[model samples]
Target chain A: MTARRTWATARRVLAQLRNDPRTIALILVLPTALMTLLAWILPDSEWQKYAPPLLGIFPMLVMFLVTSVATLRERTSGTLERLLSMPMGKGDFVFGYAIAFGVLAIVQALVVAGVCFALLDLTVRGSAPLVVLIAVVDGLVGTALGLFVSAFAQTEFQAVQFMPVALLPQFLLCGLILPTEELPTVLGWISWLLPLTYAVNAMQHVVVDTQLDTRFWVDAGVITGMAVALLALGAVTLRRQTR
Target chain B: MTTAAISVRDLTIVRGPVTAVDHLSLEVPSGQVIGLLGPSGSGKSSLMRAIVGVQVMESGSIDVLGQPAGSPTLRAQVGYVTQDPSVYSDLSVLANLRYFARILGVTDDSVERVLDQVDLREVADRLVGRLSGGQRSRVSLGTALLGSPQLLVLDEPTVGLDPALRRDLWTLFHQLATAGTTVFVSSHVMEEASRCDRLLLLRDGRLLAEGTQSQLLERTGCQDIERAFLAIVEGGAS
Candidate 1:
């Protein structure tokens, strides 16, 4: 396909995103509401005392879950196939979705940040830009995984079914409700592979200590790697799905 | 006459352990209306998709509009309409047309012309899912017609249309052929298949025959294309 046609496909996906009010609301509202709830409920004293990980990782869960509704719907409704049949590249579609979901993630993070600053009286250890950057990376990882899920899923129900398969394991290993340090060696190794573990570690540093550490960079790297891997798998799966 | 618009040599599609389209070799010339007539599971839809590069073949070669089918450059030159009316249900008729036109690299003027030709101008603002079945077919046809593609591949375009509308759609296909677009339509209706300039008869994942309607009728010593088809299949069975 020509460059012009690729642009047109991106424009079409954007238009559909705009017209689908339910998706628009989910994209814009759900993350912020979840963020507010998590921020007010979890504090440094409570976090350090009981479930420290959940306080930091809750936003990552919300970001990843958001893609399930929008991306999965597009694949199920035949919109993705329709786009593929046209003069659009699979890479373009993936990138377009990444950008859309990334924006929504940022907006959600900001709302949570706002709530964190005001109600929870929290401050980040790292630079504000670094904190947002980590959040965006987590969002991209979520969206990429969602894209892979949509590619293999034959129906909306199948797509939704992936959420539990995707979320429950991450929640367990992410050190969100359970501390990774306290987990067994085998489980700790598994947690290291998950993108959420790194993301929460990075965000937690910023949200709690207001400092940038090696852990932040390490988290970003892991999440970025997961995004790339998921994207490659998503492309191959999408190609096979259409074929 | 123009060169063959689509040339397939040893085209084969395999699903699991079964050969869906087995070594199907055929040449379709430009401006000719060709029918891929077969029963269910005879690979009609699979063949159409293979020709358009939407289906991957296990072993085969396809040249569409003098270019290999899977090449992105060549893929853009042929229009493919699938079995379903896959327009967004929430979008207006005009919105869907414009969206497809843009994706196919056609301008708004071309979109308007195609919609007008399909008689969708009056309901351009209506939602596509609300449109009648026949009207949806026109929209699908209009999408394929945009950019004036050199070849058109439509799989079962008239499946649910009333007899009258089906006939009208055939007329539109003929008109398109006159304008130099090679039209390959898949249909199970024998009468509809007879209207094609040439016919390819397929059964059990193999090519049963390929020739003009009259040639098939004469060769099989049958009264009509439908009888010719039945005779050949029954004879093969026995």
Candidate 2:
């Protein structure tokens, strides 16, 4: 948990990503592209109504895909083992990854939110910074969850498989398609257990409510708490040896 | 007595049903190049991993640099290069070295120093993915060389390297030893055993012999290390 080592680990991850253009596009460009497409295909009124929730969803989805596969690659390539053999602690690696991906998540959220407000003419009742804040928090949740999930996967292919199994259900149950309260009791309870539900609820609150409210703070707190918990779990579960 | 660079006492490691390392005990002195010579599955890599504090052991103890093996204090003191090239393929050789140098808490100049030592200065800017397998291995080795670590545990570093490169690497190993770095390198090639200052012959997760080339040869009544190794293996079997 040395701060200098953790920062070094984070800088190393960023340097690796800097050398890779495709990953850069995936991290920084894909969210903006997807948001623009949503604006273009849907009618103006529909786009305005749907953009807020989708904004929360896009960063989470993209960050999850990127973080899981990247971390899995680190495992398969023996880079993680090499790092572990050095003085770096498992916490350093996990937190380093969280911080690195957290930065990328902020960049991603800003790009997506900027496009939604500036280019698409989408408006929200609350502060624009709040929208960006919720999006960034959603991205952090995705990053933490991805790190936690990568421990269960032995290969990059299996990491990709986890997305549909682990994340798709959360997407379906997070009130994007239908309101949670409108669903069956069991299903609504399940949605309540998911971090994505809190993320979506907070973003929706920021978009529709003019003033900060208790519900908004509670939702944001839950999302942040989930991220921290998952990151701690990831650090605990990380295996240093490939065999 | 001079302090041993590494001391393992009755170390045992099990992977699944197989006992990969069985009650192995040895001492590696400082400022020497020792080779752990064994076949592919003889637990050479596993033993090396244990010495570097990465492998889980069933029993016994390993002390490195006056600390328990794998202690936080030993992190910068030990450098390890795995069988597989562990550098970031996307980054150039210099970039990979720089990253590891930072992790080792060394200045960036250490990167250039290691690159020069491994004779990779000309290709410092080349991406590791684009380098040949041997060159990529040198980059991995270069990463371990940062901070002039007290002990270097390299697992099968020359497995796929050309004879010329292998010779060059052995020369570098001796040079590092001359500069007071203890090197514990693993190799399956019998001919390479003669190049080491001392040898630990392993078979089926146990040590067959531990001594200089002539000592092993004389003890086994064989003319060369290769025949001596075969004789020892045969005698152990019977």
Candidate 3:
């Protein structure tokens, strides 16, 4: 709950990440590479049309995997127990993670969008900053989701298993494969409930509009609320000590 | 005049059908290095966890620093190092200490001071993962020393250490005690009992005896603490 302690936790997480070069590469470089590969694999005609929404999805997916596993490491390593025994609260621990990964998400979004827009020629009618903004927001959502699911997992392998449970549904139903309206009625309703559905919708809104539009605002609000709710859940489930 | 650093009364902890600490009543005096001695699974860990306010108990109470165990006020006052070297192995020793000191709101100079105490100053920038097992443990110990905690709770810190390193750590514990820090150390190694200011001998979640080395030796009429422990266990059973 204390801001100073939360800031300290964020710095500690960043320091830990800095020490591992492989993880750094994974965090800063992998998403852009995968997005480029996506541009290559898909037909040229389809790639740009899909790229904007995919920008949102890419960071969320990558950040989710990385954040969940990293937090799980903190749990297993006994550092979490030590900190909780100190003057640290669950809010400081979880939100501190949010701030650290929030920084990572910004850097990641910029790199991935930078490469796609500059080289792959992904077209956007709206402002480029809006595209980057949505991508960053999606990354935050992914980080929140990662932190929440890590509570259920004891080992790194178990954390990986949680990805499918927490993320795959959002992918399948979030309009990546098909627009939410074209799906079966039950699935369409379900997709409306998924945070990534709003992420995809908001990105699609950006693809056609010139400035911040009303529909984009609505989707942004919903998904942003989703991020806050998920982060709170993460804090609630985070244990001070392993019983 | 002796004041209680820690006081536990009728404490019971049930961990899924096993009574880890059953009706345990004991008091640790201020500024004394009290050893909680027991065989493996004798509830030493459970008792330590209770005293630090991390473990859930079935009934009873523990008071630490005149506050209920686990109170927010005591979080900074009580320093606990688990059996595992819980420090981040991925970070440098200095980074580990700095991060903990920040959480405790202690000055960063304390981080350097702790590095000196744990003898990790030479390898301050070295990643904890690269250190020897004994060195990694020192990092955990260094973390607990931050903020000049009033009470230090260490759980089985010497379980896997070499004899020389173990002796050195014992020296550090006594030094901290002399500075008016109540150090509670747990050990299953009977020989280490002689190093503590007083001892609480536990077996199967209950206290067998509590006294100084000489008192325990004389009371049980044995030559050494090891034999004295066995005799007490046998006599208590009968």
Candidate 4:
């Protein structure tokens, strides 16, 4: 893939997002707001116990929603087909989207982490920077998964429908709602198949373990590997024309 | 002798159980405005998509600009406009063109030139969503015009345009042809047939005739291209 073409695609995507104020607010504000709301509503002891894992999950959910709908919009509007007819390789389009959303994920992670640390006065035993890293990776995984899912959806409504089918199960089983260790063996085995489990596991380690140890590295590696695999799958599944 | 801009031999495309383009063979000479005239569902758009390398064919082969159709090398030399206007509605007209220009490796200034070519300079900064349908189609056309591609495949670009706008677009097509760009335009409207330097009349996925407006009329002893087309269809049936 040509770097210049990929960069151009990324820039164009960002430019389009700039014009969409609602989406901008959703991308930058929604996760932070949800985190703040949760922090305020929960008791101090429970907040301390739950905040870090919630932070990991929030970025994934928001990025998945935004990227899937946005990419699906391009498909439904026929713009993706038009772009494909150009000299652009499938990698350029997919990577361009990944880079663009990756940048947004960085901003999203930073905003949520900053608010969690500075405003909410949340304490992480592990390195705070590690929390941000896990969050960013979580967002990237969301982006990759969204791109992959958009290929199967014909309309934005159908894309939104994927949240319940593809993402909600991860939320339930990834130790966000119930701890994986506490889950039934069959349910826990299913959690191993999800990328978000590793993201949540890594972030939870940063919150409780106070150090980047073997567990953290393994979880981070799995998350990164899943992101790459999903991105590649997205590239392969992308159609030149909607049939 | 100059090579045909596009050459197809027994091109057949089937979608599900139905044949969309049936063993079609034709040659489009360079630097000419060739119109693909057919009724709706006559495989006009499918034929255009195959030439641009986007549609899969059941059989047959297409050669565009001396290369195999849909070759990566031909990507820069060929431009295609789909039947629907495909510009991003959220983007300004200039931004849409600039995006495509960059993808095509054309200079940034090419965006302005294409906008000017399509008479969209006045609304360059307007969001495509705010533009009229005809205006949006012009923006889509302008995107295809970027880099002055050698072969432009336009599918039903003038469907909803006013008569004057349609005439203006045909003039632009002729201007591009005069500058040595081969234009392959598709339309189901019979009236558009006469505007083309060469015409390929299609029915139910097969070609009925391929010739100039006058040649078609003379061959069928009809005064107008539409009647000429009807005559040929009737004669074939009889």
Candidate 5:
């Protein structure tokens, strides 16, 4: 993809988002609010225990909703088709969106992670900056998946509906409710295949391990690989015209 | 067909159970406004889509600017404005133009040129969502007009504009053609048909008649485009 086109798409998306305050709030505020509510629900120590992994998943869920809905709007509104006809590559459009949402996702990551550490009394054995970094990467993964999933949805309602279908399995099997090994053999296998599992697996090690360990490296590698692969898939699958 | 701005040879497009464009063959000459007129479902849009290299044809071939339809080279050379307002309403008119200008790899000056051309200079900074329906269409027109493409395909561009705006756009079409840009426009308005250098009349995804306005009237023994179209369609039916 050409830098000019990708940067143009990103700038245009940001300008559109700037005009839309409600979507901004949804992307930047919703995660912090949910995490805060969860902070209030459990004891501080117990909350810190769950917060790292939940931080990984929270941005994923929120960015997925925002990115998918926004991308689906481009599809249903006819802009995507119009832009495709111009002197542009599908990667330019998709990656431009990824860069735009990825920027906002970084903002969301910082805000949410800051809330977790300062307000929620989250203290861990490892690097909090590393936790924030993983959270940002989680946002990128969400952005890629959202861009990918939007192709399957025809309307905003359908796009929103995909969140559950696409993410519910990730939540259920990502060692959030149960450790992966404690699950059934088939489900445990499925969890290993999911990026959320690896993401959660990596982030949780932050609270338990004092240093960057080999297991954490493996999980981090898997999640990062998933992000890159999904971004490529999204670019390839984006239709330049109605099929 | 080889030298024309666009050439379609035995092209057929099937959408669901119906053939949107049925074995249609036509040569759109260079540097002129060729108006395509048809009934609502007569494949006016489907044909425009094909010219823009976005539609999937069931058979035959379409060559644009001496290249196969949908070729990478044509992306910058051909500009397409569909029936819908294919622009971001949340952004201002200026923002929309600027973004398209960058995407088309044109200089920043085109945004100002299009703003003036579309007569939205005063509202350039206003969000497109807040503009009138007529003005929104002009924004889409401005998007296509960026990069100064060799072939411009606009579908029903004047559907919502006033007579004054219509006249101005027709003037602009001729001006672009004079500068060696081939403009392919589609419209249902019969009055606008007379403004075209050539016209292609379609019915049921088939070419009913085509020629200059005077030629069509003389051939059908009718005084106006509407009657000429009716006469051609009715005579061919029997």
Candidate 6:
């Protein structure tokens, strides 16, 4: 809970991200560039109509990739262990890492939002602050998932083994590619339990809402609650690993 | 004698159904170099891990630096360099030093001074992963010595070093001992075994002997520490 230690951890992580070119590219360039490319290629009829849902998927994809890659790299290189040995507590480390990744997620979210406006000629139906809030919630959830995966992973190869567990289930059940109404009853219930499902729905409410929706706030609350739960789980898992 | 730097009472560590380190009550005094001597799988490394809070003890109390081990203050005061070189391989020697320096909150340029002390300032720009085994060991030593810790715990530090460097490293250890740093080095090296101020001989998760080199030899009527170790292990059978 110490802000000073959290800031130190965040600075160290920022320095590493700056030094790593591939990570920098992934953080600053990929999301917006992909958004622009998709905006340009898709015509006005079919693809442009699905821009909101597709755009919602972009942040989760970015979050999953960045956090998974970053945590795995840190664990494999022993930096995670080194951090654990420092004066910082487990909660602070998780919060600091999540804060930094949240910054990156904000950047990526903005780029996607910017591309939607500039390239696709689409206006956001909701306020920009709501969009930023969604990014923050997504970032926290993603950081927790990444740290949880890193706890069980001994190496980068083993960390990659969590891709199916971390990413694939959300894509399949989170109503990304298909509608939740079309999914099976049990599978649809599982999708509702996913953090990303709540995040995506919240983003959709932000970017495509015709009027104020109470369900969007509920979705945002669900996402935030999931983030808190995942963070607690991550902290316990990390404590076990360090011991 | 002053209070023991390390005081463990009935220390036992069980990894699942297997007891890695059994009921091992012992005291390691301040300003003395104690060697935890044992072969692989003999609970030597497990003892080191339990000392620093990395491994959990099933039932026991470990008092380090006059407080319970794994306390925030005790952990910050003690320096533990694991058996494996835990330095960042991608980071240069200077970068590695700076990272630890920042972590320890040492304000001055202590990294260069530590590297100089270890005679590694010349290769400060080289990546740690690219360095030879002995050089990496020096870096690990530098890290443990960074804060001038009262209790320096090193696990198998000289495993890959050559004879001459190993001798020099032991000399450095003795120098630290004279400077009042309580050095605890775990190793299976018999020759280096003689350099410790005291020895904690362990086998199969139990303490076989704990005393000075001369005391152990006289008690067992053995020629050297190695012979004394064999006699103790063999004598335990009867």
lDDT of 1 by residue, A127-207 (tens): 666656776676677788888786667667888899889877987888766778988999999998888888777766765
Cα lDDT tens digits, model 4, A1-243, are 689889999999999899999988998899999989989999988888788888888888888988888888886787887888889988888889999999999999999989989999889889998889899999999999998888666556777788678888898899888889999999999999999888888888988886578989999999989998999988887766433
TM-score of every model versus the real structure? 0.86, 0.93, 0.95, 0.94, 0.96, 0.85
Model 2: runs farther than 4 Å from truth? A40-45, A151-161, A240-243, B1-3
Per-residue lDDT over A42-140 for candidate 3, one digit per residue giving the tens place of the 0 to 100 score: 997788778889899988988898888888777678777777788898889889999999998899889889999898888888888888989989999
Give one digit per residue, the lDDT tens place, for model 2 in B111-171. Answer: 8788788999999889899999999999999999997898999999988999999999999
Worst 10 residues of 3 chain A by lDDT: A151-160
lDDT of each: 0.74, 0.88, 0.88, 0.88, 0.88, 0.76
Consecutive 10-residue window with the lowest summed lDDT within model 5 chain A: A151-160
Choose 3 or 6, whichever is better by TM-score. 3
Which candidate, 4 or 5, has the higher lDDT?
A: 4
Clashes of each: 8, 0, 0, 0, 0, 0
What TM-score does the first chain of candidate 3 have? 0.94
Cα lDDT, model 5, residue B50 = 82
List DockQ for all candidates: 0.39, 0.57, 0.68, 0.61, 0.73, 0.32
Put down candidate 5 lDDT per residue, B123-206, tens digits, no spaces: 998999999988999999899999899999999999978888888989999999999999999998877888999999987888
Clashing pairs in 6: none
Candidate 4's C-alpha runs over 4 A off are: A152-163, A241-243
Give per-residue CA lDDT, model 4, range B85-194, as digits (tens).
99899999998998898899999889878877899989999999999999999999999999689999999999999999999999999999999999999998998987
lDDT of 3 by residue, B1-238 (tens): 3899999999999877799988988899999999999999999988888887778788999999899998989999999999999999989998889888989999999997998898999999999999999999999999999889999999999888888999899999999999999999999999998899999999999988988999999998899888999999888742
lDDT of 5 by residue, A1-243 (tens): 799899989999999999999999998788899999999999977898899999999999888888888887887787887887887888898889889998998898899999889988999999999898889889989988998878655456777788889999999999989999899999999899888999998998999889887898888888888888888888887766553
Which candidate, 4 or 5, has the higher TM-score? 5
Residue B127, model 6, lDDT: 79
> Any runs in candidate 1 off by more than 4 Å, and if so which?
A1-7, A32-79, A112-133, A152-162, A221-225, A240-243
TM-score: the better of candidates 1 and 3:
3
The candidate maximizing TM-score is 5
Q: For all candidates in order, state the fraction of native interface contacts they contain.
A: 0.39, 0.64, 0.71, 0.65, 0.76, 0.23
